[model samples]
Target: MKKNNTFFYLCTLLITVFLFITFTTIFSYFMLREGNKASAIKEFEVKEQEITLKTRDKLKIRVYRTKTKTIEEMDIEEYIKGVVAAEMPAEFNIEALKAQAVAARTYALAHMESVGGNGCGQINEGDICDTVHCQAYISKEDRFKAWPESKGNEYWSKIEEAVLKTKEEVIVYNNSIAKDIYYFAVSGGKTESSEEVFSQSVPYLQSVESTGEEVAPKFTSSLRYTNANFVKMINSYYPNSITSSSNLKNNIKIKNRTSAGGVKELQIGKTTITGTKFRSIMGLNSTNFSFVFNGNTVEIICKGYGHGVGMSQWGANSLGKNGKDYKYIISHYYKGVQIGKYTEL
Candidate 1:
């Protein structure tokens, strides 16, 4: 009887051990399979999210935010959208906005350092800045805050569409990314050549007719400065240039005019200054300006708003209103340039 009882106990112990091993194997197999399935699902979701937000040109740009004093990395397309929104008026025609989008993209690509061009030298780690020195950029939140409550979304959507439509388009010259891609607010009925404004003769940045900009707000602006103040300001920049304010008309004369009707040089007393420099010193609107002396106060009238080089924003709007497409406007302003994808070289 004792032997039979011991045999039964041993058999029961062996059966329990076998069952435990079997159960553990089955549980581990199912757990592993479920874990793998969950991982696969998570990976697919991540890829889908990437596909939703990722642009074809995944190039990143590092911008130094002047207000926040932080370097922010963003996709190039997003940067262009912000630039177009901040640079051009949201009320501008869609075609003009699209041209601005392309111009901004070309400028950014030309200055990008990751692709072998020099980045913005203002900061070490940044490719550009959120200022006019590089390109004005406004954050979506700030842009929305500045817009009317009802029109914020509508305006932003328009800018986004402009950028999306002109994706990856850049101005090129001779099968290469063009240099000195510039754009400004207004022109003096015609665009200035790169040689006249920047002192370099770029083939693509030649003089072109830019009519219909008279409707712009600052197309004809005037600023008054007392004779004494004008002489003081000019002397401050070019010391001892003008001796007195009595013979101001004779002392300050425009030496030559540019092809586009802007002042090329000005003779102020013994100092001969370029119109560009004088404009900066006197805080005038543009190089295309004239002075009127009424015995005491000198009123400087300017016919444009910016340097008068490259594309004119107001002119572009006029062209767009006249049924010109973005491509036509771009080609009109920038001569001999091809609109295409940016060349890496």
Candidate 2:
């Protein structure tokens, strides 16, 4: 009995010691994992803070003045003010102007050589041009010359305010400055995707609903051409496409429409062309168009203006009037984009 009791005590001691050792090992492993997780989180926070802190800098740009045929250096913020003034109407909602300001800044930085971008191809030694080829820019003298005396100063001050309020803000996608920043006057009722218009599949430049653009001056327009004249025009661009003007209605057919309801392809006699090419050949405002054959006269009615890609200025104004902020306006037009300080390239 004594021997059995001693053996039992020894067995209990060994079991307890083994259990303690196992528990200690498990606890140590969990503690080490938690510590590693905490370290990783702290490191991420530090990197984010560094990105924020490094955003402050005074940047400059070289602009190619088409009128003077010269390359002039200017402060980037001042250039943005000029761009906002030239690109958007001063009478528009303030929030809309702010959105335009951000877009202009992003566009400028995208072509600026100082920011690791390829300079404009239109110029040999400049960041960008002061024309619609790159972006329209009006100097103080030219702005005053263009605007009425009473409105020039007030309008310029408003544009300056818009630029100052959204200083250095840029549209970023996938952690980089977006290069395809295109804007237009109107979108009819919807904006077009980049793939449909420019043949480039961009993630953020996808089609979306853009309402309240009917108030824009260029929302709807019409061009009239006689049947004979229309045939001449089509033949001028695409030689001998239209042979007969008697059955003009049967000769022309809309091949297909885009996702946003813009004409994607059109069949005119023997020639089938993209809607954009047709718009160019026919002098239409946009690809969203329809024609009516009234007797011998053909009237083409067009909706929207410009390329119909990216943000719509009038649409932004409408959203701003409806109490949407600039950030909201930008996010609505540019899908899945982040607005922040100018990204370091």
> Candidate 2 on 22-129: residue-level lDDT in tens?
999999999999999999986464323211212225577899999899998899899988888888888999999999998988888888887667778888998999
For each candidate in turn, the TM-score is 0.81, 0.83
TM value for model 1: 0.81
> Largest TM-score belongs to which candidate?
2
lDDT of each: 0.87, 0.87
lDDT of 2 at 243: 98
Model 2 backbone overlap count: 0
| 191-273: candidate 1 lDDT, tens digit per residue | 99989888889888888899998888899999998999989998888899999998888898898999998999989999998
Runs in model 1 with CA error above 4 Å? 1-57, 342-345
